[model samples]
Target: SQQGEEDPQALSIQEGENATMNCSYKTSINNLQWYRQNSGRGLVHLILIRSNEREKHSGRLRVTLDTSKKSSSLLITASRAADTASYFCATPAIGGGSNYKLTFGKGTLLTVNP
Candidate 1:
């Protein structure tokens, strides 16, 4: 089973500021992914970091993984009002051939004020 639970269920910040969210898992995972979902929209894959990787970056987003702690964090730099969305962390489901299945966290609701 894959279990990733995000912390600080909600956050509010102004545009141009930075936002950070954390996630913790219960079991070992091969990789972890972060996703964003706008209100009433499908999820957008943000980033994916493997167990062997400590950190990865994409544009204004940064993600770090610490397997020993079974946690990960997502950092959004220079936040924009358009960036307001719900962020979730996901991990692959257990069992071989289950890579297509993912378990996601409850998510963190981010509100970026313009």
Candidate 2:
């Protein structure tokens, strides 16, 4: 079963504006990760926040996790048109041991217009 559900199905903003996206999950997870995908392309990992971590940051991206609520959020600072893409939240499958695969959310489509 898919674990995460992202909100605001889509967002549009001018360049230089910050964009925020959120995700809510159904079950306990070992870790939560964010990914970005350009149109007609595969996804690229953005950041990962473990269940034990409350917050993490990489470059202009910030991520926060709340295991108690089974939710997480990603914030992109100083956004640019190039940052436009579909962002998704993912978690490992519930079972499958070391061979588990990632289950992704529906994704939030972000459009940064110049």
Candidate 3:
């Protein structure tokens, strides 16, 4: 079953500002991954924070994980119109081959005004 769920179904922000989205899961995860989809394009891997890691960063993106709370958050700094897209949090499926399979959340749509 899908474990991750993202909050703030939609978000609007101005260019150059920061945007943050939160995700909460119902069960344990070895790692949580964040993905970005622009319009109709396929999902692009953003970042993955391991259970043992507290935070991770890639380019303008930052991800924080709290296993105790079964939640995670993604932060985008210095946002741009191109950054506007739907972001989804994913967790490994609970069972065999979990490492190869992922369950994604509904996603959080972000609109950055230029």
Q: What is the lDDT of residue 57 in candidate 1?
A: 95
Model 2, 24-97: lDDT tens digits are: 99888889999999999999999999988999999999999999999999999999999999999998775566
Off by over 4 Å in 1: 95-100
In candidate 2, how many Å is residue 103 off? Answer: 0.2
Q: TM-score for model 2?
A: 0.93
lDDT of 1 at 96: 64
TM-score, every prediction? 0.93, 0.93, 0.94
Point out the higher-scoring one by TM-score: 2 or 3.
3
lDDT of 1 by residue, 1-114 (tens): 548999889999999999999999988889999999999999999999999999999999999999999999999999999999999999976656654578899999999999
RMSD of 2: 1.6
Error in Å for residue 19 of model 3:
0.3
RMSD of 1: 1.9
Q: How good is model 1 by TM-score?
A: 0.93
All candidates in order of lDDT, best leading: 3, 1, 2
Error of 3 at 15 (Å): 0.3
* lDDT against the true structure, each candidate: 0.95, 0.94, 0.95
Of candidate 2, the 10-residue stretch with the lowest lDDT total is: 92-101
Global local distance difference test of model 3: 0.95
